[model samples]
Target: MTGTIKIDNAPLNKFHLKITAFTFGSNFSDGYALGIIGMALTLIGPQMELGTVWQGLIGSSALIGLFVGSLLLGWLGDRIGRQKVYLLDFLLIAVASFLQFFVDGPLALFILRLLIGFGIGADYAIGPTLLSEFVPKKYRGSLLASLTVMWTVGYVVAYFVGILLEKAGPDSWRWMLASGAIPAVIVLLLRIGTPESPRWLISKGRIEEARQIVKRFIGPNVDISDLIADGQSEQHSTSFMMLFKKKHRTRTAFGCLFYFCQVLPYFAIYTFLPLIFKAMGVKDDILGNILLNIFLLIGAILSLWFINKLSRRTFTIGSFLTLTVSLLLLGIWPHGPFILVMLFFAVFTLVMSGFSNIAQVYPAELFPTEIRGSGVGLTNGVSRIGSAIGTFLLPISLASLGLGPSMIGLAVVLLIGAVISIAWAPETKDLSLDEASQTPESSSQDVVSSSPRKKMSSH
Candidate 1:
């Protein structure tokens, strides 16, 4: 078997499980940090006497921070190493989270939120790239997909926590914001001493170190010769521009577009569900938000179960199609009865949650070890741009165009995602890492060379 195959086909073990747990913690922290702000804003808005523009700034500051953090840290991870950058990001998050309690004004709070987002962005790029390099291909989809589930869980739990803590008088938002520090510090401690990626090492031509890590953490018998040998022809570097080269450009574009489309609607809706529900004239907007987030959490969990069962292309295309249809129904009938409006929201959330399964994992899978960190980071940064735009605009859209038009606009975004997926999504379901990461032209060549007739004739 090839070195990539050897790594991909290895049995899931204790080490893999531990890494998954740590990564899940990282994602959970990220979800909480992002989600808590929506609820906190209710109090922050009034107490700080902030207007729409300031609210948008406060809400999207982290995402803006995410854009910066993802690009800088992702490239840094590639240049320095995943392990070195891994723990520090969480340290930054924990510190920022704790500082949220002391923010006396909107500016201080926005800066703090931006810092927290920056840390989460770094983890976004590093966590999946590291996990994908370690896990077996058979379980890779589900394991990596679980990261989103944890994020949704974190998000849902944050809302529930916000509801419970809302009784903490006028100062509750401070505690809600600071609570994210708990998970961040815990995950940071657990991530300590995690080994470096062997594939990354092999790509760097540190053969002995790669072999030892594979043998120690993975297995003694796992062969890495194929991995090292294959690297001979690759132009190895961590440069951001490398992702745009002919070999990787299509994947780079596809990664950014699909991720951008997915999150634009998701973050926009979830980050301001309370505002949206109020716009719909829900009797109890808070309870409605709770129920919707529950659906979101459920879909994320189901995605973990279904990811390995379905092809990546199928999941990407099907979920976006469903999302588009559901949102279109809601957009078309914004004046409908409460039941119908919520039904559409439920359907949209479920489909989007399912789509989240592929979002993080797909980007990491698109590039080889040589630039995996940068590739995931770049796509992540672009996706943040979508999310930031959505979050920034949702309040204004709700205020100006009302709910109907905004929902239709989201449908357009999902429709675009569906079109992109149908056009570009590849079948990387059971392929080894090296095979899956090949550029389209190179991958097609491999299929032809490895065809049954060619193999039979050669024999």
Candidate 2:
């Protein structure tokens, strides 16, 4: 048999599990921030006397900040170190949360949300990179995908908190919004003093540090000479432009397209689900959030099981197609009865849950250690623009064009995403990150050289 793949084929350990949870806490905070904001807006809108336009701005302010954070932090992480940027972002998140409790006006709250989004954006870039770098290839997909589970759990927790505090008088919204700080603080604590990624260290030419990381956490007796060789071959400096280089161009396009396709509709619908529930005749906001999250969580769990079984390309395309169908049904009858609306939303959430989980996993798989942060960060940042635009305009669309047209538009976006996924997304299942991130030309050469027939002749 061919010798085992050294770099990515290492065995896993407890430290890996611990760090994975710590990293996952970032996604939990992200989910909480987005989830709590929706309910808080319903309450805060009237208290602050905000209009539709201002509500939309408040809704999208963090996303706008996220756009900047993802790009800037991703670049920074690669230049400095993942550990440094990752920890600092959570601090920003904590400070932003505390400041939000003091908001007396729309502008103050919006600016605070924008600052929170900045930190979240950086987490988006740095967190996944840290996770992917530490985990062995065998467990990487599921472990990385578990962030979706954390996100769903966080969302549910926030909803629970919102419901519990709903009867706490007019200031309940403050409690809901400010509560996000707790999780961020916990994440900061959990990740404190954790080592930087070994893969990243190798990419930076710190072979000794990388070796210690591999030996201590990755697996004992796992050789990494090939990994170091590959890291040495890659471009060392960090920049978004690195993604556009010939080797990474195709993968970059795939990652961005994958993110934008789902997030555009995902944010537009899920971020404003509370409002959408009202439009659909769901009288109890608390009940609606709990019920909707149940199916959403179920879908996320299903995706965890299915991710390893299904091809990334096929699952993504099918999810978009399914989402398109659900949106089409909603567009056909936007004001349908409660049962009909619930059915459509259930389908939409299920599809969205699967897609979102896979989207994060793919980005970590597509880029090499050197540019992984920048690659995922840039695409994530770019897709945040899509999310922001979609969310900012959804309210306007609902008011002017009616919910029918908005659903139709989301359907169109899904269809486009499906087409792109079918055309470009590479198969990443069963491959280690290094193996998966290799350029097509390099992979082909490795395939030819590792042919069984060549090995047989040598023997």
Candidate 3:
């Protein structure tokens, strides 16, 4: 009976699927909320008489709100609990989404979308952190990678929904924005009784509670003994400052930088796909966007397999380099033949989808249970800053720099991401949670199988 349970190699079970379903829904809601606005804006801009500045504000506001939500609530999730915050944030998203249907002005709509973004941000911090802790290492990479696919599906679905809703009438923009409530509400119900992470429980020294939950939900023989031993050092501060401390600073930098680089161009390009298409001289912007997004969705689906097949470092670095090349082609030949333009856009979206998939898995794996939420949140928050900036400035850039130069700028961003990946991306494939979270210097020790070291608590 002693030390018999080892979650690192445990087989997939029903509980794992349940957790994945709940987390998947959250990412789906996020993608829908963020993507719907791009199309809605085409209608809202003229109907509401919004200029580029207001449109940019309205477009980027949710991303700005994400920055606030992740930095604050992500830290709070660590102190409180994941399930509590998970349900709370969904309530916020659902309420904000429904409120959008009643907005009379651009300012009101902006505020509502920002609130939705805030809720989505909180979920971003919690969902992967929660799911990653519960999933066995055997399926962890693919399971977590699947979230990005859900997100892409949600984003593509938003476009399809937007196309249909646009035919509903002048007020259709209101309904389009509010449609985000549907997914949020559904996920909220799905998460109603989800359990807290046993790792979080163990980190907080509720060892008996952790053991009982793991036994009941996971299995009686699944061992959390090492987790219990690790809990003894639970005095590590969950403060944001701790992320910048010597032990975690490298990971913190890589997580934030890589995420920021990937999303800056992603939000910038995809959020205005129609506009980019028109600028590129595409005759039917709407149809072109749909096909391009389909390619994006395909890339996300493909990454689920690639994540396990290639080392994380190799996949990430290669994805970025490929993405950079795709964008550079479009940049250098802004008015390329119709087929070439479509091909470049398709390549960029496809590569970007796989590159962005890392965002779901890498940040959560960077920190221990005590601050996993915070670590994920901090990276998410920083990345949103990049997203917000790119979203807000894209229109302005297009107006001044023209589409060709703007494409070049985005290509440069991807090139920077490739360099950063080469410099710092860690290979986390096949590693257990304990091994993945540790710095390279200390990861040689298989702490999960080793005898507990004797130590006195600071407390």
Candidate 4:
């Protein structure tokens, strides 16, 4: 016995990897649904003759739904089991997508999106948290980062598909909105018999059940005796207020506020990328979306590579600075030629690619097994408010203040995110979920029982 007895020693097997792939469907669907909105809005706004407030609501409404979904599903996952809450969300997404296809007006569209948002909200809260719980700690950071890539991939695919279908006429947007049902349906169908998070079972005091799950995941060869012992360390249940306790309070603040600052500007800028381009005289909406999604994919690829390598604070703070500078350039030179705007815009997308990747990992990593879903859900809920504010107000901001001022305002929000990252971003590169969430006293008391690294590799 030489190293810490963290949960990493549990086998990283095919079953775990399969779970990872299945979880991708949710993130992919989320990206597709949300990304499609920008294009959908561009078409619908004129047909409906929408006002600024209505435009804002339509854009932000799904995000509002996300907050509601996160709160409800997140708690439900913690109370019930992650798999149960996980499987049902995709059904909700499919239903909402179909409803969105038939909806007549902004009000109808808004309600439908809210329902879709709720489904996405559950995925946002549960996907990463559950993935982190299931995977080996050795690959947790990289594997979890892949969820963001899957999201970007879905978004990029939606944009490309939208471009092809542009010839379908104004009705094309409805088709685009409805398209998400395909993957949601696919993910749901694929999730048949997805296993419960053994960690959740352990948290619920079902020690024997957790043991059986560990054996299946790690293979029958290895003994999970100590693993079960380590897991039982968690108290039987947790309340929302417990997230506010001293041990976890700081992480909660960091989780909620950091995401708030980042998404505040991120959503505002990206949600309105088309409008921003249109105002700058870039006429081809399809080309504009293609470039944005391409750059976004490139950024996500870069993020996928760098997430494990970069220091958390350095990465987060640097990304915000990059976003701030790129956005500020757009604001300062409001009328810069297309190439200049495109260059800055591409640079901003590239920077956020990596940053946003880590942003997804942080909340999932911040808390312990007992409340990971609820905690991440709450933080994401806060992010939705930020997104809602940005989305709901961006149209008004662009109209009232023009491109330069709106971009500058967004840059200011990114700056605030940089500051928060500097102040609070925690380094989580190779740490176990349990290790990352350990209180100071707990860390001191729960000394390593053996060479956890050696033990983890034994099987």
Ten-residue region with minimum lDDT total, candidate 4: 442-451
Which candidate, 3 or 4, has the higher TM-score? 3
Q: Which runs of model 4 end up more than 4 angstroms from their true locations?
A: 1-7, 231-236, 441-459
Candidates in order have lDDT scores of: 0.86, 0.82, 0.85, 0.79
The Cα error of candidate 3 at residue 415, in Å, is 1.0
Listed in order, each prediction's TM-score against the native is: 0.94, 0.93, 0.95, 0.92
Better of 1 and 4 by lDDT: 1
TM-score of 3: 0.95
The residue-level lDDT of candidate 4 at 13 comes to: 74
| 1-459 per-residue lDDT for model 1 (tens digits) | 534437777899999999989988767876787789998999989999999888888888989998888889999999888988887899999999999999999999999989988988898889999999999888888889989999898998899899899999999999999999999889989989899999888777888998999999999878777788887766677788989887888788889999999999998988888888888888878667877888888888888877878767778888999999999998899868988898999988887887887987798878888889999999999999999999999999999999999999999998998887776776666767776777745543342233233324433
**Model 2's TM-score against the true structure:** 0.93
Cα lDDT, model 3, residue 320: 89
Tell me the lDDT of model 4 at 439: 43
After superposition, candidate 2 runs with Cα above 4 Å error: 1-5, 233-237, 284-286, 441-459
Query: What is the lDDT ranking, best to worst?
Result: 1, 3, 2, 4
Model 3: how far residue 196 lies from native, Å: 0.8
In model 1, the Cα lDDT at residue 203 comes to 77
